[model samples]
Target: MSKIFEVPLYPYQRCADQDQATPVRHKVVVVGAGPVGLALAIDLAMQDVPVVVIDENDKVSWGSRAICFAKRPLEILDRLGCGDPMVDKGVVWNLGKVYFDERQVFGFNLLPEEGHKRPAFINLQQYYMEQYLVDRVRQLQAEGKPIELRGGNKVVEVTQDDERAELTISTPDGPYRVQADFAIACDGAASPIRTMMGLDFVGRVFEDNFLIADVVMEAKFPTERWFWFDPPFNRGQSALLHKQPDNVWRIDFQLGWDIDRAEELKPENIDRRLKAMLGDDISYELEWSSIYTFQCRRMDKFHQGRVIFAGDAAHQVSPFGARGANSGLQDTDNLAWKLKLVIDGKAPVTLLDSYDAERVHGADENILNSSRSTDFITPKSEISRIFRDAVLDLSERYEATRPMVNSGRLSVPCTYDGSPLNGDDCALMPARTRPGSPMVDAPVPGGWLLDRTGFGFQLMTIDENAPEALDVDGIEVKRLALTTPGDADGYLKQRYLGDANSAVYLVRPDQHVAARWDHYDEAAVKAALLKAIGR
Candidate 1:
């Protein structure tokens, strides 16, 4: 394990709010200081929203949890002003190979196309990510931004009324009351806030379990994801291998439903398994080891009155597809803007309902995919196992059947297809970049396209006639005029404009397309803007 976890990033200290006459009031109070909480706080603070964050621990996590971060989350970190360090410290890879018993079935490339700013995926430890985010929070504080990080503060109770939410946090000195106009619970999967509020996740709990072991060693393994099905080392089971920043390698071994978890997690037992896979002569040290079960579940609604839930507090999924943290970041992305608008009084409170609508839609999609991946991985019945093996056998031979092998259908950005915030869509334009879809990245003149469209509503004009700016009521819509699509590496034309010659897009604060048209229309753009914010 790295010494980074030993150092406290946000050590607790006595704040003046604790000695106030009454409960100190705040604009927003976040319950957890995990990645989702910190990222959401940063996003809100970046938009000039005053935020207060509280967590029990002040350091990075112990184990290398959630090692694979997908491209969408990396882009989100980029917007949050912390992407460069994460990408620099991460191990980038795009290829993954699968095995059936002793035979190498086939290999697949995740990102075949180029011109996008970020890659398909990067293998980074969760601790490094949290460290960088904490550093960003400190930088924002240095810039005089309204953001506070308090460690050793545990939430003892939670209560909420119509106008605001209240929390009692226990500190080293004593407990004190804090009030917020709105509260966000990025607590965790086993959220104490969710429990105090009488909320629970509703979905499927898979029957199989996997043992996660992070081992440190010097080896010549290539930087890529490797999975094995019924391999010679761990027969009748599955295994996964991934590379991280340090010499640590994360390995997950499928240890069936019924087993002695305590016995399996023993260091000697874990070392035995590693020897089986990497040969007996190799020297390695077990850095971390734990057994985790699969769960595909979520709360029915992300928000209850004034308090909103984001990240693992709102949803949980199997880790096979790298969807857990990635989707949580997307939750923060879908939420911060909507919540900011409501607090600014520029939009109706009902705009927050769109956050619940769009993100719930996203959660359901991730749950569905995660459940399918789990089912494919650990079949319930013998006949199911036979069918799975046959598919793997056929996958090794036929190109069409290769896709049938489900080694975790990887994490991808979700499009809120029927979201209420979505507006007009043109059949003449491209489908990938249509309304309710995430704005695809492309090479622009200076750097990248996503660098310009974040934390604010903007209009992207591609060979289309649109004004430099427009004001719909009090909401200002800035324009990203790209008169020359040819200056871009033709990706803008292919991703945004397929059959249409000219295109205009209404992009939300989170960079999702609210609406698009073949050509710019003043009245249509205004109407779409109104609907996109739930007018």
Candidate 2:
């Protein structure tokens, strides 16, 4: 194994008791050291929020799980200060091909636009992702940011009320109690905190199991997503192939639920499958393998009193669309800012409710797309198979029917169209950049438009100078001169301003469009900011 895949165990330290005299209390207690939890903790710490993360495991995830990350998540990571490292260490790809048996049906590209800083997707091991996030947390700690990570610390019991949450954490030494103003459950799908709170995740249970194998080999395969249905190597089932860093290849095989788990996982049984796909000429070594079942489910609510849920703890999706971890990262991105505001008293506690609403909307979009992709890939009934086959057959001949053939709708950021935080839309403004949509990246003078917008509310003005600094607190005013160095080539004007020469937009901390106007309006901006904070 390469050094990049080596698992590093973080030493667990003894924490002071909360039951003792003058107990310590944390502003935020995150109940998982996984990627989502670490990312959220790091984001909060960057904003000077005191956060402590606890996890049962001392090391990162062992195998290559959740390897594909989309552009949106990369941008979110960039905002959190860990994007460049991940992009540098991972394989970048924007092209994907779909195959019907041995014949290629069609191919597509994700990065059809230009001037974006990050690629459409990158393939890196989950361990590396977690490690990068952990490193970011440590860097913040060194800067005197109150971010504490406790590995080997497990939350055995959890209880939360309206104002605070009390948790019993078990370490190597013994169990101790800790309290926090708010508790975020980034724990995996089997969340103990969620179960303790009597929450149930309700959705579809797929009847199929997928066998994923990460093998180390040097093959002349293009760095593109290749998905096959009823391929010759894996008869009557679906298969997926993608490239990972350190010459590792991730291969997934769709196995029916009836197969013997033990029998299929054996080296010999696994060898047969790989040999059939790669041929006897290619030699490879298997690094890891696992079997997983698909489930698209989520809790009835993400927030209950002072306890909240993010990532897999809140929802789950089929692996077909690579929505699992990417969406989880988005959950934290949408949440960390809101949590920080509430903790600082800049916003009411109800601001957290918007996090729940927005993330729930994102989860539902992911589930719907994932479920459709799952159905298309592994048709459950005879009618489903017939229609799937028909679509596949027609895709080769007709371009019109090609859109119906969805191997997997690759992950994309969901827009909170009907979100309560959205403000009134400017009638003449372009609909694509309207309220509730993420800020589209465009080339600016020195960097990208997104790079110019910092971690607070921003007032973006196009084609004209931004109005004089407002008295509003925590809002940054940014002016963009279109056709100049600020927007040299006019892409920003074409994409954002359209035919209008001057417009002002109120962007939220998370970079979503809060409101837009033909001219800057102080009262409208104030109202939009208030709505964004869930007032």
Q: Best TM-score goes to which candidate? A: 1
lDDT of 2 by residue, 410-458 (tens): 9997788999899968767777788999888888777887777646887
Q: For model 2, what is the error of residue 164's alpha carbon versus the real structure, in angstroms, after optimal superposition? A: 0.1
Q: Mind giving the per-residue lDDT tens digits that candidate 1 earns over 371-391?
A: 888988999899999999999
Cα-based TM-score, every candidate: 0.99, 0.96
TM-score, prediction 2: 0.96
Instruction: State the weakest 10-residue window (summed lDDT) of model 1.
Output: 483-492
Which pairs of residues have clashing backbones in candidate 1? none
The lDDT leader among the candidates is 1
Residue pairs whose backbone atoms clash in candidate 2:
none
Q: All candidates: CA RMSD in angstroms?
A: 0.9, 1.8
